[model samples]
Target: MPGRVQGKVAVITGGASGIGRATGFLFGEHGAIVVIADIDKEAAIETAKEINSLGALAIGVGLDVTKESDIKDVFESAAKEFGTISILVNSAGLNPRLPSLAGKTSEEIWDKVIDVNLKGTYLACKNVVDIMAKGGGGSIINLSSIMGMVGYNSVMSNGLSPYNPSKAGVLLLTKNLAVALAPKNIRVNCLNPGFVETPFTETLTSDAELYDNLVKLHPIGRFARPEEIAYCALFLASDESSFVTGAPLLVDGGYTAQ
Candidate 1:
């Protein structure tokens, strides 16, 4: 009757709102000592409070995915307070309007998107892996999107690209880390979600036609709830996936089936 992640210490990047917040809450629900790390300090504290309300240990840290100092401080504190980092959710990423292969998007847009989505993920994984390795073994889950697995659309009318390739990069990063960390018993994986109704996509929710179209696109006939994606992440980060690594688990509600 033990919870799947009992006694585990998990640090989630971008754990203020959207999927990150939901995952933090659920991870605690399942017995993880949750650390909600985010750039938005106020929101992170609020999220930490919510987790504590659930009778689980929780803390919030001000962190920026682009900053090594922040990652170091958080990991050090987490290691000291919550014990070793047994779970990591690299959910910190951005969705900037980018350009296409040609002269489509602006240089600034592409840089920001790649910096936050790819570089950000790299930093978190790089910092956490050492902690996990020292802890013996752990699970690392990176967030990718359906756009990464396939070209969903043109990121820009002029040629800007946004999420497609960045997510694709995440997909591969997950696999690479899995292989590299396998010798140490650490598991690395990715979660690819399609059109989930979370704060990250709340702006799009107002467009009825767009929302309806998104629903129709999924074979399941609905966008996923944040908790649904959290469930998939939970499985990957827990012993439930003891034999799973270097795998990209699709929580797209069958959007890729088409």
Candidate 2:
């Protein structure tokens, strides 16, 4: 049997690690030519190499998602290299540096969090939708969080800053873009993940007790591995989800079921 995404071209931001890296590997294994884009140039290259080891085509790109020109260039290069892009996965974002709401939150930090988390998604969609549209249609997967679903007790010493709001913004962005691009045959969707054990989340949940407590918050009493989230992204990025759009598919281990 052929792969689900055979011959497709996919651009994945934050592709150096965590969900992005995991998704890159899976996409490549299933036959999509992958473009690994990240701010960390070396890691991006390494990830591309790792994906290439799976016997699929790939390239690593250093990019600042906040820069429109950089984003445009990524899509342009992918189009030139692969003919046209059919998939885009926006997975680049970060939490504010750990600080109490009083000690860590600042105008600069707020802007950084929102700029990368929200604005990055906005730009990726703006830039890649056209590429997909030109190809008749395509799929877009926005990385949101369970944080966007409701207020949670954020342990960031400086507090939530713009991370929470930016995620919430992505939820709406997914919806609006889904509606706007539906006529063009493009599909837009989001994944709202609960706490997953990744290098990025380790800073917050490395504590055994705290991590366990976090787990208990979920009906499943465990955290999702990065691959779990990546699988959700894969489904969204594939034709299997051709009818799905404007939906924030929650993979929270029942964190929001309460």
Candidate 3:
């Protein structure tokens, strides 16, 4: 029997590490041609090599999602190499801590976060939609966050955290794109996950007390693994979610439930 998403082509942004890397591996395991696109060229290349060593077809491209030229170039190359794009995973994002924001002004912090988290998603979608449509429709998975649905805990962040608004924007963008592309058979959706064990959260998770406090926020009392989130993306990317679109699937370890 064929694997889910067999023969589909998936391009995952931020695929050098974390959830994006995990998702790329999962997609490859399920027989999809995977493109690992990230700003970290060396890491992306290494990831693609690892996937290929496992008998999967995968490639790495240096992609700065915040750059339109880079996004266009990556997608175009993927299309040329793998045929019309079929799946897109917009997983590139940022969540700088207070110290990282220290030197930067509020406006700068907001711009950096919004540019990478929100504008990047929009640009990736904008570039890939035409390819997906031409391929008779496909799946586009955007990564939102539980914070998008609810404000972060006061201990975790201030009320004005740009990460929250950026993710919230992604949630809305997913819905809008889903509705607009339904007629063309393209499915647009997002995943709102709680804290996951990824490089992005290393700063917070490295501190035992902070990690414990963060885990306590989840009703499940633990953080998510990258694979757990990847499986969710696999479901959305496959035909299993044919009827699912414009939906924000929460895989939050019951974080939002509390």
Best by TM-score: 3
Q: Clashes in model 3: which pairs?
A: none
Q: TM-score of the candidate numbered 2? A: 0.94
Question: Model-by-model lDDT, in order?
Answer: 0.86, 0.88, 0.94
Candidate 3 TM-score over all chains jointly: 0.97
Error of 3 at 107 (Å): 1.8
lDDT of 2: 0.88
lDDT of 1 by residue, 1-258 (tens): 768899999999999988899999999998999999998988999999989998988998889888888999999899988679999998987775212233534676677778878888988999888888999989999998887888764322344475677899999998999999999889999999988887677656777877777788899999899899899999998998999999988888888987
The count of backbone overlaps in candidate 1 is: 13
Cα distance off (Å), candidate 1, residue 28: 0.6
For residue 45, model 3's alpha carbon misses the true position, in angstroms, by 0.6
Those runs of model 3 whose alpha carbons end farther than 4 Å from true positions after fitting are: 98-102
TM-scores, each model vs. reference:
0.93, 0.94, 0.97
lDDT of 2 by residue, 1-258 (tens): 677888899999999988898999989988999999999989999999988887888899999899999999989989988888999999988776434223644787788889999999999999997788888889999999998887776543445457788999999999999999999999999999998877777765778777777888899988889999989988998899989999999999999989
